[model samples]
Target: MTALAAEAVRHDRELVARHAYGDPEAFDEVYARFSGLVFQIARRMSGDDALAEDLSQEIFLRIFRHLRGYQGRSSLKTWVYRVAINCCRSRLARRSRRERAFVAVEEGRLERVPSAAEGPQGRLRRREAAETVGRALNRLPLAFREAVVLRDVCGLSYEEIATVAGVRLGTVRSRIARGRDRLRLELERGSS
Candidate 1:
């Protein structure tokens, strides 16, 4: 490994050690740092806020279960992301089997208590765009969608993504490239 990569691995080892052996507070600190990232991955992958929240909570539960024994062969983020992705995949598969297939809730179709952070109009537009992109994303095959989310939205390095995906570096590159192209086409077509 490169020096930088080695340093990252060392850091993750130390952090995991701290969480495993230190006071309970150390685990809380780890949770605080990773929860948002976990939530983001869940939300983007599942395209459902409520489901994403549930998944995030479930992810944390799993993390706490396994964090104590992390082997440190990969960075902590990659390991957590792998867990998040696996959770999402299982949830999606179960949902699909339960129903014929999953369907996205239409944009602004969700009833919300109004918030002043942005006017209702602004929120609507943003929601619509998000819905459009999400619908487009959902149309992608899971492999392509995951590669896109992991690299583009979640911002993992190609090497990290390979570790998470259990694929080679070249495969990660191809998936990301193909995913981006598919996304572009979907956006232009405006229907999935």
Candidate 2:
């Protein structure tokens, strides 16, 4: 492993130990270590950068508040993910009553379209395809999207995803399968 990887692993171990022993510095270290991951997950789930930032902060705050209740039943990383998913779910629930308005603005569009002068039309096509996939992901129901993101984007194993999602292992597999199927259909519609 690289020096950086080795250092990170060592730091994670030390921080976990110190936090378990009630060290405030260790809590700060944990926050710094996992905040980016939390933020990324939040952004993917909410599809809004501003809301994601707010949700990420709320997730970490909950983690700190509930740290004492952590029983080491799962890895700390998985537990952190569980908290993030719950935070995203709560945010989605609270917003469900409001109609989501999408503004038709140029800046909101993904920068995938190329100028007519660009010779590599294929590259532009690929970017458009990727943007389509992103849009389809954003449209999926929160539960399905969470499963897809956790299993595919974050590359978590099925067992880990099940634990983090608080679902049975079989349910995690089923949801991932169904989510992929739905996304594929959406992509096909977009392409046609």
Candidate 3:
């Protein structure tokens, strides 16, 4: 690691230690630093604003409860990411099962009528494009989705993703490639 990178890892270790030792502000600092990241990951993985908010709360609670047990093997960021991803995956599994048993009333949505405030066609096109991509992302398999989200959305390096996912570095690269290819295909199919 470069000197600056090493220093960052060391700082994260110290932060975890401080939190474990009951430094009252340590966790608040952590929350301030990572809350946005956690929410972004939750929002992308779950594809719902309200569910993302709830998942973010659960992730913070888990971090608080398990902070003392943190091993300091990885940076605190990677550890928190793994925790968040695991929680979201588990919750999604439960939700999938429950949803399979019932038909959702909100499954179909009405088309929006352009109002005076939505004046520009370009802006409306961008919104539609983003929604299409979001739907394609939601269709990805769990492993691919996680890999893509960590790398593409959360912007983690391949090495960091390997560490977080407990997989080999090559596996991370391969998953990312395949995930991206699948995502592109999904997007193309949607456009068709």
Candidate 4:
């Protein structure tokens, strides 16, 4: 790690320790630092804003509840991400508990509405495109899906993805690449 990266990790470790000790300010700072990332992960992975909000709340609750058990083996960011992804996985499993009797599905929603500029046909085209891409993403394997979402949707670095996924850097790279390739195949198959 660079000097600044090392310092930030050290600072985050302290913050996590302080929170474990019931320091309210430390908890607040940690929340402030990571809530956005947590929320975005939940939101993107779950595909429902309302559900994402609830998932975000659950992620924070789990974080606070398990603060004392944190060993700092990974950075606070990585730990938090692990929790967020697990929560999302659970929520998704429960939500789609049928055909997917026992599997993880992080099917994200395309919740964008084209502006007034899109008119009618354009809006239809946009919706179809979003659904097509969303389905392709959803078809990825769980490992690939999580890696791609963290790297592409959450904008996390490959190193961060590796830490969060508890995998090696090369694994992260392979997962993302394979996920994109699978997504491309799915989309092409759908369009045909």
- Top candidate when judged by lDDT against the true structure: 3
User: Model 4: which residue pairs collide?
Assistant: none
Per-residue CA lDDT of model 4 for 121-168, tens digit only, reads 877777766665654565555678888899888888999888787889
User: If ranked by lDDT, best first, what sequence of candidates would result?
Assistant: 3, 1, 2, 4
TM-score of 3: 0.81
Better of 1 and 2 by lDDT: 1
lDDT of 2 by residue, 90-142 (tens): 88867744534542232244333333355768677767666666666776778
lDDT for position 46 in model 2 = 81
Best candidate according to TM-score: 3
Provide the lDDT at 1 for model 2: 55
For candidate 1, give the lDDT. Answer: 0.79
lDDT of candidate model 3 versus the reference: 0.81
Query: How many clashes in candidate 1?
Result: 0
Task: Mark the regions of model 1 whose C-alpha exceeds 4 Å error after superposition.
Answer: 1-8, 99-131
Expressed as tens digits, the lDDT of each residue in 48-117 for candidate 3 is 8999999999999999989888876777888999999988989887876676433244333323323335
Query: What digit string (tens of lDDT, one per residue) describes model 1 on residues 1-192?
Result: 899989988977887888778668767877888989999999888777998999999999899888888998777888899999988888877874565433443322332322325565977867766666666776667788889999888888998899888899999999999998987765655432
Ranking by TM-score: 3, 2, 1, 4
